[model samples]
Target chain A: MSLTADDVNKIAYLARLGIDTQDTESYAKDLSGMLDLVAQMSNINTDDVAPMAHPLDQVQRLRTDAVSETNNREAFQKIAPQVEAGLYLVPKVIE
Target chain B: MHTKTIAQLAKGLRAGDYSSQELTASYLARIKQHTELNSFITVTEEQALTVAKQADMALATGNAPLLTGIPIAHKDIFCTQGVKTSCGSKMLDNFIAPYNATVVEKLDTAGTVSLGKLNMDEFAMGSSNETSFYGAVHNPWASNTVPGGSSGGSAAAVAARLIPGATGTDTGGSIRQPAALCGITGLKPTYGRVSRFGMIAYASSLDQGGPMTQTAEDAALMLQAMAGFDAQDSTSVEREVPDYSAGLNNSLQGLKIGLPKEFFDDGLNNDMASCIETAINEYKKMGAEIIEVSMPNLKLAIPAYYVIAPAECSANLSRMDGVRFGHRCTDPVDLNDLYIRSRGEGFGTEVKRRILVGTYALSEGYYDAYYIKAQKIRRLISDDFKRALQEVDVIMGPVSPSPAFGIGEKTSDPIEMYLADIYTIAINLAGLPAMSIPAGFIDNKPIGLQIIGNYFAEDKLLNVAHQYQQVTDWHQQTPQGFA
Candidate 1:
């Protein structure tokens, strides 16, 4: 259950987070410890038990498809890192 | 004026003992004097005075709301329009919320003047306040001790009388643990009891917002305004919010109190256990019948919680990329670079640890072994609480294992910090309402008596804590310098 350096790199990449090279070893250690703790759950028999998603087990409520929110594009985009003409500018994703 | 509880302040405001403007000024001054405690992140002095004046005009009309002219603060986790809602993360350091959270809106409508946002663990992640991008909040009781968080500032401010009351969110003992450590009253209402519309999401299923105050009576007043249904939050309950203060003075005669055997086990500090036992004895003197109940799965809560909360947090926090409203990195060559560096730079060490753990748990080939298994264990833990509550009106236990530890004491070890919440985490998993009240002091550090109730049973929990506060003066003892 020990997360090696390779495992840390894979997980961090999967999470889209960049871990410092020096910190990767420590991350590996911490993640390994957490895995050990969560692994304790395997000791119990949950074969027939259902996975509880919500505390009250209530289903997500549906609402009408009609618009319920006011447009606040300008207000929201005012704090964006890069925005031009009401569009958020991001790094080029495609050539 | 700052020493008075919310109830007393309300009475004084109505009786003209002092103007709301005067009261707000007094509290603002107190907050300035105790700045060393690091309880506040953003103090809204100008806005508070303006709101205080409006409250005075409303009071002059003779039909002002119950909370009108009262000064309180919100845990930075809540969205306060025009005020910085940092959520204790550099990611949101520069982001100003465009609107108020439903809880903030409700309390504002009740005419409560907000002092400003208080500090918290970054995105409500850690047990102690150390994970905050803003420096850790100090417990007023002992200057060097850590204030239990992620509602450390709310608890510390209320305990020091810097503010009459403040709002706090509890995912895994965020509100109750800090309240226990700071010697104040904190209530974590039933999941969805308070709307989470504008509150930042940490663990969606388990996160709940409630009141942190000096006394249960004040907590009841705050909860009355805070509790309700909001169409904005799909999980917000549709049930009626009862009169929270009506049953505060209810007799505890015939009360079936459950003392879970697991809570008094080897992990609990002996001295702290005696203080809790003494509080329970007082409950017995008032005609409460104590019944020993066993909740064996209680021991498994921490592990299950670490799995589920982080898994949800990892997903929820995925929205904090560079393009959106929060912090963004300098130059990035591509989208992946943007996402990775922004998150890496924005999140703290503890937050990164959680996100990584959650990502691994929910990742390919490991989802069933970690996430699904943890959820099943969550069900077993909830079942344990359901069975125990069936035999008792409410359950009693120590809120935290021991009193507040020194700053940096448990920060190096995440597991040790997580274990400090053993007593309070299970209630969140079951979605039951619970409260933490100052029971007594251990070596001048405070310990809280946890009162847990059935789902949506906030009134009962408040009554239980209120009755105890009536006989004991522990809740009244303020820290020396602050007083």
Candidate 2:
């Protein structure tokens, strides 16, 4: 499956990336190259094999249901792009 | 001081031959002298001296361990509290980590003085350091040549003797490829061997932290402290980490080494293949047995890894959206603009390319065709390793297809660069332990011999590498001008 400029632009949008129009053409080419490379998987018959998601093949370990973490809002917010009153502030969403 | 290995330095400190302060200071001077290599992204001088003095106190008290007072650098992927953990990207240029990664905290307990965070490919993507936002790391052997990545800076720093050792992460061939190109020893342990609590996520299943050092013995010391179970990291293994340093002198008699038929098939460089044969002959003389093994599914490692890694990265990096931490756009129209522009300006071309690929693979319509199929093929690739390891003690092959290439050699074409990791990526796909040790050279550029072992077989891999070093001096051959 080859990716066109529109397909790449949609991918960039889904990825929340602002890909410039000029780079989209190049991206389409590169993405198609990658797609062509991965298309070989279709030839291999993995019909009975289970998809291995994790290496260890174990579920995530459960922990106690309690407040284990300390309050580090001040420390955490220090690196925030914009923080006000210990809250991360972003551009207005609600109209 | 600059020429000594980690073991020699530790012995010197124990015998009162030199203080940790003197060693740290000497290394700091060398790091400054070799600034042209662009190995270091940040050098924590004041903190290094402070830690060095503390190590000296421990030495004076006669309570120092093997790594006490030794100066080392960390790949920026491991977050260091109070330091700018850039991961070699502009996205985190101003982001100071709020806490230390498990690896960093373990090193602190070992009393290793940190030089600073080293450079890496942006978010540990890319086959060469060319993708690093800071700049490409220059090969110590040749300035115009590239050091392999994403552990390029770590390999270059250790290779140049700026520091005795460093920490590196391998999601694919990151650690071993760079180590091979720079003529050092780098070990990528079993997937869950080292805790990933604080290390930045790349491909979560494949990413692992390990040691980059001058010798296998030194790598053992570093890996000893770095491996363990962590409650914070849900995926960390719950097993005992044996004394890796204790088994370095083990005998190699009757050790069955599998020579993968797939590794030598077309695409390997001629001189590099010769060097691999020489190294294999060395092992034969050491009383080891060599057998040919065919891994028919190994050819699919590249495609499987490219798909699986990016898919995970797309999800992992989604958290970097502008609101919480890291780079943010200026005067965004709204939330969508903030994310789009911040990511656009923040990520490099290679990183963006991967994110786009990953997003498409994991998207609604193509999920089964790309993402799930890759995962199924991942199982086939791993099963081949299981079968091969059953016949031999370890698998032997070239770490990279060739010696270090020129800086801009393959950067223009992504496929060409991706093939550079052909031999090394299969190990990470299987989540097994593997290492790269300097074997020989091609036209003065270093080549590496890759040793791969079954799950949690780090000791056996290090033992074989250590025995090889005992017979050869390739790891000791430094870059001419730097020496």
Candidate 2 lDDT by residue in tens digits, A1-95? 78899999888999999898889899999888988888878899999999988876878889889998898888999889998877789888898
Model 2 over residues B1-483: C-alpha lDDT tens digits? 787898999999999899999999999999999899998999999999999999999988887777999999999999999999999999999889999999999999998999999999999998789999999999999999999999999999999999999999999999999999999999999999999999999999899999999999999999998999999998999999999988999999999999999899888878988999999999999999999999999889999988999999999999989899999989999999999999999999999989999999999988998889999998999999999999999999999988999999998899788877889888888899999999999999999999999999999999999999999999999998877
Runs of candidate 2 with Cα error greater than 4 angstroms are: none
Tell me the docking grade of candidate 2. Answer: high
Assess every candidate by TM-score.
0.99, 0.99
- After superposition, the stretches of candidate 1 with alpha carbons farther than 4 Å from their true spots are none
Chain B superposition TM-score per model: 0.99, 0.99
Quality of model 2 by C-alpha lDDT = 0.93
- lDDT for A14 in candidate 2 is 93
* Candidate 1: clashing pairs of residues: none
DockQ of 2: 0.86
Calculate each model's fnat, 2 decimals: 0.84, 0.81
Error of 1 at B74 (Å): 0.5
